[model samples]
Target: MESFGIVKAKKNNKIFVEFTRESACGESCESCSAKCAESEKELFEFPNTLSADVGDVVKIKTRDRSILSYKFIVYGIPLILFMFTITLSYYLMSKMFMKNIELMSLIMGIISLFISYLIIKGIDHKFQKTNKGDIFLEKM
Candidate 1:
């Protein structure tokens, strides 16, 4: 993925850029004004290889594969785990306990969702350490 931003500061090889944050609601919702109240610009420090200077407009890019994997980890895995655990727990409860299967399955599904969150946190930590300098910058 690529985005354009203005460099706000420089320290060694790192450049701090300010870019507009994209709204998930697409700025079309009339019922909610909370998103509009939030700041639009977000700052990030990226390792600069392009010799970009403060006040320069630059293009930043991240690998598509990296983004895809991140999305899968953040959104996909937990959803699948939640549904799978619900069904599996219900089935097992029906066979073994034969009582309160619905309640038990709901509880198990929530537990599985929490476990998925922990797993995602661990994965995110590892990925951050290994992919610290994955972003690239180019002067625009």
Candidate 2:
């Protein structure tokens, strides 16, 4: 999964950053979605946070190949749906209900955002269930 985060703080020449790994449960099945999902097979996470300086743009490199597969389903699907919902709601509500397109679009956008939050939360909960100390950040 490609994730971006700004350095929140720096100490001892080590950068402290916060990044989100998608829920692991999403990868437990054939239809799981969540960029952070992984197969039930043991996942190895490094033990230490990556070393980087505050405000530095750093890339995280992982040898895991499953990230790509999860990204397409986990992130891509909702992104596409969000766009589709916004467009469709605008057009349909405008014609069918005589509502202003902009207003309807705004409402739909908010709805999409809420849905996204729910999805992420669901993933988080699932990931927490597997509570393994192996997940870690490495600076690259």
Candidate 3:
């Protein structure tokens, strides 16, 4: 079975889709990892597809008991933490030393942001090799 969804938001280049429980997947299913311990109301973000914009409807095919895509987890968490730590470290160090904290924080934040972008882009490239959805987008 599959799920039909509508793109609700786009942030940092990722497309978020809102899928209802009444779709083919049903309101109660043991197939979804997110649903196994939570409610059926779900939002999925495809970090790769850029062809569709916000408000576009999408279709996603799911196999019973399959895991939600791990592209985000494997890549996103690390990138975010890296950026945050870098920025925070800069801020803290400058504050403790009574240096130009704001400027240092700003500069480090910008650099960390770029690093995060590169990390995410690399992960997207890696996902493209193994996942078809990472490379294509369509409107339903």
* Tens digit per residue, CA lDDT, model 2, 1-140: 35455565676555555555556454445464554554232222222355556664444443344455446647876787788888888888877777577877878887987787688778768756674432345455
**Cα misplacement distance, residue 46 of candidate 1 (Å):** 2.2
Clashing pairs in 2: 45-134, 50-139
lDDT of each: 0.87, 0.59, 0.68
Please provide, for model 1 over 90-118, each residue's C-alpha lDDT reduced to its tens digit, 9 standing for 90 to 100. Answer: 98878896788898899999999999999
Among these predictions, the greatest TM-score belongs to 1
Stronger candidate by lDDT (1 vs 3): 1
Candidates in descending TM-score order: 1, 2, 3
Per-candidate Cα RMSD to the true structure, in Å, reads 3.3, 13.1, 10.6
What clash pairs does model 3 have?
31-65
Order of quality (lDDT):
1, 3, 2
lDDT of 3 by residue, 1-140 (tens): 56678899888878888887663443566666665445356887787354778888888775433234454655666567667866787768876896777677667766766777777678669766766543334578
Off by over 4 Å in 1: 10-13, 23-39, 48-52
